[model samples]
Structures are given as structure tokens and as C-alpha cells.
Target: MASLAVSLGLRAADPLTNLVGIPNYAPAYLAFHFVWAYGILSSRTLKQWYKLDHQESPRYDLVKYGEAAVKSGKITKRQLNMMQRCESASANSVENYTFFLGAIGFATFSGVDRQTVNYWGLMYTAARIAYGAAYVLIEDRKVALVRGLLWWAGNAACFALLWAAGGKLNA
Candidate 1:
């Protein structure tokens, strides 16, 4: 599996091994890229549905069109909620990408180990995927626990990154 290869490759590389400017976190980066792309693509479903339903003026503003669709009986409450969750997931992914960028900047400036960043980044990426899926697809109360678990995993990864980053700060 590609992930297996990436994990193996990552394990082989030492965080202490310098890569000119930063340690090679390519495996983590690759996973980040894949997850980010999926987030972007996931948002399109709502747009496509809105456009198909509103041929007269297909352009959508979530606030306006979303409410309109539900009111007009064009989409059910559940569908609208799912679409909103998907769109929110996309936005959260962008925020996560920003966090990655910020961490890399902080790590490089502080001389933090690339291995630390890479492993933590990978964890965050995987957790994000699970959290996003739970956010968008599941509506049942019984399954809320699944989402919570994913959220905790992602949150823990984020905390790990922060801790790693803290280790290298000039303070």
C-alpha cells in the first residue's frame, strides 16, 4: 500500500537528518496534499446539486441558496445539513493546511526536528479524514461517538505538534 511505503520511508528518515533547509517530511506532505485535495473536492457536491436544482441562477451563496433549497422543498433538511457539514469540512481542511504551514515555519525557525513534524503531520491528516467523514456522512445520535473519537485523535495530534514546536522555541 502507498501508505505503508510512506510510513516505512518516514521511519527510515531521521528527524535529525537535515534536508538543506528542513528535514524531509515528504511523506507527511504527500498525505497532507491528498487530504487537502479531497476536502476541496468534497465541497463540490453541494455546489453541483445546487446548480442542478437552480438552473435559473445556479450560482450559490450557502446562506441564501441553502435556506432557499430547504424552503422550496428542493432539498430535505438532512441533505442541506449534510452539504453544510461537507462545506465546513472543506473550510476546516484549509484551516488545517494553514496550521501545517504555520508549524513548518515555526519548526524551521526554531530548529525543530523534521521527524517530529512529519509524524505528527501524518497523524493529523489521517484523523482529519476520519473526522471529516463523520462530520459529513453520519447523522444518527448513536454514531456521534465515532465523530468524538476522531476529534480527540486529531486534537491530540495537534497538541503533539504544539509540544514539539514548544521544545525548540527560543523562550
Candidate 2:
């Protein structure tokens, strides 16, 4: 393993590489967005889960279910609003996935160092998670500025990754 890291010009102690003990970390980092979105949308403790617990699989058409429930008076509009916010956060994650995947994928394939890739991956993930959580939990427009900041922070990581990848590719 140490030999493998040495061969790749990567340190054994780099965070994601250390976590997965692999030369490439892009795929793992990319897949985490799916994991995060799934956890947020369908996790056991989420209100949407309990509200839609009657279904065999609530995730297939969560928006439809939530809308129907609200229309039929089974759930309140406020409840629907929260569910939509959660869904929007998950959708935002999915929406951002392609760009992130491209940036990180290019970085790893272009020979960007493992430590740099892992650091940006960690930053992107943390900022995105905080952004999503804040989006779901905060209703105030004033406080919601935090979510916007986090979104920019995550985007900064992606731009940083692209810059690093471009440098490596150019060299």
C-alpha cells in the first residue's frame, strides 16, 4: 500500500486515500453526494419518511406523494412545504453532481496530488452538507444567507479542483 502511494506520488496519510487506501479518490468522493442526498431524503428519522410510511417505496415519487397528501387533506401545506424543501435540497445535490464529478474526475485523472484532491473533496462535501441542512431547516431569509455562503464555498472547491486539474493537464 505504501509502495502504491509512493508510486503515485501520493502520501499514505492523505485523508480520502487514507480512508479508502486507494490511489484514486474521485469516484468515492463523487458517490458521497448520492449517499448524502439519499440520507437526507429518505432517512428513517426524517418527517417525510414517517408521513409516507404507508407506501412500499416512498422515494419513487416523493413529490407526487407529498402533493397528493396535501391536496387530499392528509397532510398540511406546511408539511408539504418542508417536504418540498428537503426534496429541493436533494435535487440541488443531484444538480450539482455532474460538475463536481467532472472537476474531481479530471483532477484525479490529470495527476493532481491525492492530498489536494482529498482536501477539496472534504471541503466540497462539508460545505454542501451544511448548505443542504441549512436550506431544509432555516425558513428565515436573513439566516438563509448562510446557506448561500455554503453553496459558494462548495463551488469554490469545485473551481479550485478545476484549476488544479488544468495546471496538471497543462504541465
The TM-score values for the models, in the order shown, are 0.64, 0.72
Each model's lDDT comes to: 0.66, 0.76
Per-residue alpha-carbon lDDT of candidate 1 for residues 1-171, written as tens digits (9 for 90 to 100): 534554676434334543324445745575665566464536665667665334454335556678787788877888888877777767666656656566555654566677677777778777877888788898887986798888778768767767776886745
Error of 1 at 83 (Å): 0.6
lDDT of 1 at 58: 36
List ranges where model 1 is wrong by over 4 Å. Answer: 1-23, 26-42, 50-60, 70-73, 169-171
* C-alpha lDDT (0 to 100) for residue 106 of candidate 1: 64
Largest TM-score belongs to which candidate? 2
Q: What is the lDDT of candidate 2?
A: 0.76
Per-residue lDDT of candidate 2, residues 1-171 (tens digit) = 776776687754544334435456567887788788666443333554446643566564455576777788877877666666787788788788787888898888787888789899989998998988898888777998898899899999999999999998787
Worst 10 residues of 1 by lDDT: 11-20
Q: Provide backbone clash counts, one per model.
A: 0, 0
Alpha carbon deviation, residue 115, candidate 1 (Å): 2.5
**Candidate 1 accuracy as lDDT:** 0.66
lDDT for position 59 in model 2:
61
